[model samples]
Target chain A: MAKFKVLAAALGILLVLGAAAAQASGVITLEVEILPGFRISGPGSVSFGSLHPGIPEERELQLQVWSNVPWQLSANYYGTVEAPGIVEVQGRNGTWIELGSSTNLVIWDQPKTDPDGVVIKVPLRFTGSFSHDPGTYDIQIEFAVVPLL
Target chain B: MTRVILAMAVLLLVCCGQALASIAVAPVIIEADQVQAGQVFTVVCSHGGEEPLEVALSLALFDQDAWGRVILMEDEASVARAEEALSLERRRFLLQPGQSEAVQVQLAHADFQHLYAVLFLRPVRPGPSTRLAVLFLLSSGEGTPSLDLSGWEQRGTDLTITVENSGLCHGFWAGELLLFDGEGKLAEKVSVQSGVVLPGRSRGLQVSLPGWVQQVEVRSLQLGDGS
Candidate 1:
């Protein structure tokens, strides 16, 4: 009976040590500064000149985003526009989504592609209607890049 | 002659509109422990463009929705609470090309055990502009995190697991999903990316499974201190 008790105690100690080892290996410290740099750049303005009634005009703007961590891109317009227009951004899967007044996700969970940055071309289309007056109208769009924490 | 002049003016405007604005930030995520009054932290912001940039900094509280989308709090009460909790040394500044600034942030109140906020850096220029948002996670070091696997689902070869944190403090969880075959032998293993789960919130994480995977087991679930 004494020998059996000693064996059982030894087994319990081994199990406890094994569990501690596994937990230690799995715990990753969150304090490390892994992503130290993030950058985003684009043109100051895009001009779509002289829109004619019943005609749609298209222009492209290039944006570059660089980061050391996984990040997401979103865009939103500052004010409302009466004209019918669509702002489309190409994704990694070769698809485009319309960006509107509300914040819309353009790129989701994109990994770091380059050290400098990756250029993304955004196509803006404006369709004119006879109901709207002919004048110089400007709509400011803002792009935001945030790390996926 | 007037039409030709106007056309030349428009062409000149388009040619000069190629001004690019670039901004870079370091340490995108800031995690701290035991929040106290007058606690300080630093974030580095740099102007990577050719021209000068007028930068503005603001603070706002944020939360994650069911699909892991960050929603910035805009209500008056939430904004007031955030303002009362944190403050920046310089809210607006000017940065020249290749110039960097160290932003100083000070804590005023420790009203919650765990809090999340974002520091927004925006350029004061017109037209298409790009900005950056940095996340801050602060804790009082008083409570523990209780992470539980709420549920999971499989569709085709994709699997998603929902994890809920019902504790007083926030925590980051990570682990692996073990796949087995019909003979109960281990077929493959898929890693679960580490993500933060705020107090009283749940997060859905997607994992891809092999077609031959008949059984799945979540193993080595570990939670790290996110304060």
Candidate 2:
């Protein structure tokens, strides 16, 4: 009877130590890799077809942006515009801000995580006066997307 | 019947073309700490859409404004400095659908000062195209930085603190703010988001403060180890 009692106590201690050891090793560290993704796509051109004198012509272009991290979208013109015109981008509040010769920050630190991305509309307005030339006034605009850290 | 079939085929092609016209770039920001000369880094560019993409890579000096907006520097000296520090193996390349290209960038000079440059991947095709700007930050970790609280303002629940980096190297601000009431009692503790301040530049960090807070103090401010 004495031997049996000693054996029972030993087993109890062993079980307690085993449980403690198991609990210590049960902690898990989980990790996942999220590949950085940034993409942009839009139309090839915006045609403001045939301008008239003293009349304002407005055209809109839509751009799709996809990013997993914070991003900034900026626009700038490559060369001077012979015609008096202005380019504006639609803001979150539905307002438009003019884009200048220098880099203009259209969207700042906005993140779009969807795989399909989101579309943003940019509008360009120009009014040809009677004194202006009738020839084509090509204005080349460039759009750039940079990650904001 | 033949004409109808041809018209349908053309319409299908047009729809598919428009759907696949995107340019994708990965690892938008490349950072290195204690950088050494001749160290190489890689940036991958892929064409996610169906059309072939024509990409040209170039490096330019860049700086950030007080609000952290990136501004490309175009002065002669700035351009020359950027050109002397880094070089790319593949400046121009074409990527097909589902194909990617890795451009190798080798650092020629890693001075003690922090260097900021941008790799612009521009598309050759014209008319409203998208471009990707990848930022490279390199530091030798041999210089000390000076950070000072230049200004602060309160607007409703938001508290903006402007910090100036007057050192030769860039500094990162990451710490907590101790908000106290009018009686000098602790009101609330708020964490300030980490941001980079270039040398001789100031950056504004915005934090949320409790309405009853009267005084704000920076606590346990830790600067990054140039990493």
Best by lDDT: 1
Q: Write the per-residue lDDT of candidate 2 for residues B45-140, one digit (tens) a residue.
A: 888777787788877878988877677765678768877999888779998888999888899988657888888888766443466888887777
lDDT of each: 0.72, 0.71
Please report how far candidate 1 places residue A123 from its true position, in Å: 3.8
TM match of model 1 to true structure: 0.78
Candidate 2 docking quality: incorrect, acceptable, medium or high: incorrect
Model 2 CA deviation exceeding 4 Å by range: A1-37, A53-55, A79-101, A112-115, A129-132, A135-138, B1-20, B180-187, B210-216
Q: Worst 10-residue stretch by lDDT in candidate 1 chain B?
A: B7-16
Model 1 residue A47 lDDT score: 68
- Model 2 has an lDDT value of 0.71
Per-residue C-alpha lDDT of model 1 across residues A30-134, encoded as one tens digit per residue: 875365568887765676766565555667777788888777776665444532344455555656655565556666777776776887776655555455455
Please state the interface RMSD for every predicted structure, separated by commas: 6.0, 10.7
Which residue pairs collide in model 2, if any? none
Q: Please provide TM-scores computed only on chain A for all of the candidate models, following their numbering.
A: 0.63, 0.64
Which regions of candidate 1 deviate over 4 angstroms? A1-35, A52-58, A80-102, A125-132, B1-18
Each prediction's number of clashing residue pairs: 1, 0
Which candidate comes out best when scored by TM-score? Answer: 1
